[model samples]
Target: MYKKETRGMDIHTFATDGNQEGVLAELEKGIFVDSRNEKGYTPLACAAKSPHASVDLLRLLIDAGANIHAKVGESQRQPLALAACSGSLEKVQVLLDAGADINAESPSGYTALLHIMFRLHDNEMLLPMAEFLVQHGAVMDCESQYRESPLSAAYLRRRWDVVRFLLDAGADPSPLRWSKLLEAVALGSCHDVKELLRVPGALQQRDRFSRTPWLLAAFVGHLDKARLIHAAGIDVNEIGQCGETALMTSASIGNPEMIKWLIGVKVDLELADEFGQTALTQAVQFGHADCVEILLAAGADPSITNEYGDKPITLTTSEEVVRVLVEAGEDIGDVSTEMRRILIGLEGSSTLRVSKSEYQEGCQRRFGSSNPETMDVPFWQEMIRTGIPAYESKSQFGDLYEMTCVWCFNRFGASFTALPDGRYVQIGGEHEDYYDPDFCIYNDVVVFQGDGNFTIYGYPQEVFPPTDFHSATLVGSDIYIIGGLGYHGSRRFGTTPVYRLNCHTWHMEPVTSTGACPGWIYKHKATLSEAGNITIRGGTIAIAQDGVEDHVENNEVFQLDLTCMTWTRFAAEP
Candidate 1:
């Protein structure tokens, strides 16, 4: 073992010292030239990495049958990659000439060129070594496992010269991958961006979220890049995926100069997002007093309200912003505040109340029943049994009282149906706004028996996710649930969403239907006819228009044939 260790170290030492004579002499003795040291450094790898090593030394090791592709250490460090890291063009050339793969990667997926660009920090020989590697057919866009290409790595390392060279060498700056144009805008580099603009459709590139390059400039307050992109034919008032204009983005970031630039460019300050938030509203909500003042001075309407009915003054908590809004002839008080006060006042006020027994008596009077247990059982069952009536829970005392098992009536867009065995079933629903913490889309089946007994059954998320605004029509023993709004991330766009719930076992299963299915519909009516057809009518369907989901009112009637489970759409008669 000791002899083997000594021989390995001798070859490695000779290789590291760049001693061509000693390495050749070792070859004459027929020694193992590919022997690895304790650091897993073979003779060829050591010689390739040594700066003092001549090209002949590398060639001698290669001629001696040393592995040119031999990798060492846990990183699987290749010999050619080590030579490239040394910034020696000749050593890199010797390895490449000796059948070394130019683009061979380590276990981490970094090629020899990527290693040189990423590891070198302002070295004088960086460009020459990079040029040498590139000239030899090194892939400029070969990405690492982290999706970072050679050009992107250089860009991230702030190597502008290398970035320009790589760009000139025809590296593709994919908008979906790491975007050089967006990065230049972020760095506020107009010169670099100007040079990059020569690429066709450079200014028109958008990220995955549909954020334009000009919009990114607005986000970072880079007026120079914004002007560059604008001059290059990019729209200054480009709207993002959420309908947010560049002016609104600048206002939200509290950049007064960016706001001033946007205003000077004649951007539409009144443009609102999907939430109806304008630039002034954005500034006020983020408490940017300076931005608010600038926007108002630029002829922005101070009275503009969002979809939530919140204007600048109503949304702003900043006293300075409020004063600015007031000086601009805006309303002084918040309407929401007055509404909140009214609700608070009602919270303390008392209403004429009745005892539970009196409420039961009133229920007995209404239903003509003598049993107290059966009286005022919150008659949700009776309403579904007959027809919905103008019914309120009140006793003969003319006041309301709480029931033993309080069924919350706060559900909206939920399914409530009467089962065949005299059981009432209530399906999934949400309370209020989807953004609210309490706004939960329930997937539980609330079963109300005829004997005033109720049970809540829950299914797995995969079986029944949070559902709402769908139709639950009873067809035989199975309840066929048609389309509704689920979570945005879980929405299936191309086909209709159908599920079946067995009333007997309460088991839920998804149904995959075919043939011209209604794509993502809600607020629709589903009816089971005697001919075993479920006809659907008058619902809003979510259709992807220009990559954005648009809800269009669908008046066409679609019938689902249960036998084959297919949908057939036909024109609805006026």
Candidate 2:
């Protein structure tokens, strides 16, 4: 349904317009041999745009003596340059291997690689072809018609890896072109790009924009790169176009490491930006606490207010930060009494002293150090003898102590053995705290079996009387035992027997005479609140008839009020 052009435009035009096979057949017929289109495009130039331009077609065209140097349209771009620009690497290699000029200048006088890099900005293709052309003795220093070489093109595109490879391959990054260096620094190609300015005469040579390498690197926050240039004996604190030093740029970026390095290298920290803000002031305004700490530790004045009259402490929302500034002798006039109290509390407890042998052992254990010099043995003994004291003077919740086996020292589950001395022993999870007979101190609550055969003897007398499997809670000066299955012999005395123990004597109070109370259960969590209320959570509930078979869940919450001496059912939705 398409009309052919009536004019003398030959089959070369047909090849460019999707009649590749028809044109090749006509060319083989030798009728339109060496025919030219109106635009002077050869059959090869037309076939370059065809999707079906196979290797056989290309070879046939070349054998028919087709002009490989042909250009399409007014652009006058060579087929090789067109292939490179189009990213057709196969077509490019085909044309190049077929005696197409590798370094043939385009209509714009740009070599294929330079044109590709400039137009497509593809480093993947540009780098390989550029290297290939250059390795094949394509001119490295040859300037394009636009006065830009491949090096300048790579630099402009910020392809640092390609730029580095190109430069090492003897591509001259002309120092006179200041845009190349500026572009390199702007694009973070500072690592090797700055080396271009380090060439013997390039440092002294100014760019076209009249900016030096030091100025450009500083402007772009390439401090490490700038430091490299500085190590070459250039001024570390060199002022740029706006009188901005490298230190000021680092301060603006809040890079503490770079600032520390600059200060160590003797770059003046006192140097201010155009707004008269020093590095110390910048750190405070940005609320970089570690940087502020570093600056203050290096003798930066925290008292110096910024333009808004806000000191370093005022900029921080952290209490520890304010305390740190105040401890550094920063004058914070007449702070709140509560703030003063909090700050005083922040002074922390005194360092605990330990013997040298224990300290070395502690250090060795903590740091995993085999070296004796790094170990502190005395610290370990003190840590073991007296664990850190409890924060409160009195444990309000009534103390809970864990007891383990002396040999195995394992934690006790529901199954554990009671020794003849009335001491409970567990297997596995043995620790030092388990062996301490004085584990439960004054007012500490201890749970024991309700069987009347066992007695816990402290120093002078029995601490807790003989009891069976029953739950107890410790209040101010008394131990209250609640309902449980009382033990006589091997028989279960299922009764709700309540007992109260004072410092003088233990007395039993019968709460309820209900027959066959719930069976004895252990390993239950007992909690005592501040309002004289007791809660027993999560334990087995069982009713003993003749044999202990119907043991249901005691997952329900139970509460006892010591003031009223009455039990209340907690209405928690199950």
Every model's TM-score: 0.35, 0.33
| Residue range 362-399, candidate 2, lDDT tens digits | 33212111111122234422322232332110121122
Q: Which ten-residue region of model 2 has the weakest summed lDDT?
A: 405-414
Tens-digit lDDT track of model 1 for 1-574: 2122456467777888888888888778877877778888888898888887788988887887889888886577889999988888888888888899999998788999889886674687778888888999999888888887887677555566787788789987662343678767755378988988888777777765576788877766778888888888866777887898899988887999988878888999899999998988999888899999998887889877778766677676565675677567653333233222221222211222445563344333121111112223333333222222112333323444432222222456677665656566767766556654334566767666745446556566766777888988888999899998887767777678899988887778899788978789998877777799898887798878788877889879898999999998888641
Check candidate 1 and list the clashing pairs.
none
| Candidate 1 Cα errors over 4 Å, as ranges | 1-6, 175-574
Q: Model 2 compared with the native: what TM-score?
A: 0.33
On lDDT, the candidate that comes out on top is 1
Candidate 2 ranges with C-alpha deviation above 4 Å: 1-20, 28-40, 49-52, 175-574
**TM-score quality measure for candidate 1:** 0.35
Please report, in order, the local distance difference test score of every candidate based on alpha carbons.
0.72, 0.52
